[model samples]
Target: MRIQWIVSIVSNLVSMGLLVIVMGQYQVLNIQKQREEKLKTEVQRLANEYANDDLSKVTMEKLLADGNKTMTELEAAMAKLSPELEKKRKDVDACQAEKVRSFFQFPKIITLTRQCLFSIFYPIHTNMND
Candidate 1:
């Protein structure tokens, strides 16, 4: 009977330790979710400020605007710009290769701005996953 009681106590302690670890993971997950929400908010704000700004103007004119940008607006802008930028780059490269004086240069300012914007959220996710 004494042996059985000791065994039960040890099992309970082990279960408790596992419970604690699971709870710790849950806490971390919750914190990460909050951070993700914050990042999404900021991303939307930036999208409205920089891209698809015409939508913002229309929304303001209607007076029904939430004064915040949606992901759809941002995505639409990216879809339109990505192909156009790629084409421009290809054209410039072709011109340069043929020894032609290409007037086109990739915009470093935009690239740096995008890097700075996304760097805020990406490192947090990378470190958390590790």
Candidate 2:
């Protein structure tokens, strides 16, 4: 009974740890997705506008109304969306910055640590004096 209880407790703890790691990964991936969408939209908008000169005339009119006005509006839009974009950008950058952050960051580390710990218990003992 005691053994079973201890095993259950350890299993539950391990599962919880795994859950946290999974949630973090999901969050990071979601952020990447958001960043991807933002970049895609930006690219498509620019491409379409570039491809069709007059296609963006409506927006251009706003730009032509007053040069500074366009900048101000752009700035405002950027200011609002910039934070959200920046957040996702930061997530992606952090993920890219560290090999571990990309995907399975925590799991890989945990697995490596576990393996190392297990490996230390070899079939034969090494020279303790050495």
Candidate 3:
């Protein structure tokens, strides 16, 4: 009877050890599954962020293209009007020169009145005319 009792106790201890090992393996497998799920979620979030970045880049590229097109059109328009603008600028310069000559030839009273009116309306203070 004593031998039989010893044998039964040994068998129970062996079974308990096996159960502990199995439970440890199950816990490890559960932790691995949780880690895998976390990594998958992170990957999805990063994918969404990258997708938004790509959309922003595309929008910026389109805006840049439109801006460049507008700049080109403006440059072409300026080019077409450059000669006319230059001629007008030269005519204004010649008229201003004639006015300066006439102002010097005029009497002091007329010169002062013209200068005051020119100063009030045009506001260009050239040292030669001042």
- Please give me the total number of clashing residue pairs in predicted model 2: 0
lDDT of 2 by residue, 22-116 (tens): 99999999999999999999999988878788667767887787998878999999889988998999998887878655465788778999888
RMSD of each: 37.6, 47.0, 12.5
TM-score to native of every candidate shown? 0.38, 0.36, 0.65
Ranking by TM-score: 3, 1, 2
Query: What is candidate 1's lDDT per residue for 36-128, written digit by digit as tens?
Result: 999999999988787667877686766644433556677889999999999999998987876533223346656888899799889998999
Candidate 3 lDDT over 29-55, as tens digits, reads 999999999999999999999999999
Better model by lDDT, 1 or 2? Answer: 2
**Ranking, lDDT, top scorer first:** 3, 2, 1
Worst 10 residues of 3 by lDDT: 120-129
- Segments in model 2 whose C-alpha atoms lie over 4 Å from true places: 52-130
Best by TM-score: 3
Q: List the residue pairs that clash in candidate 1.
A: none
The lDDT values for all models are 0.83, 0.86, 0.94
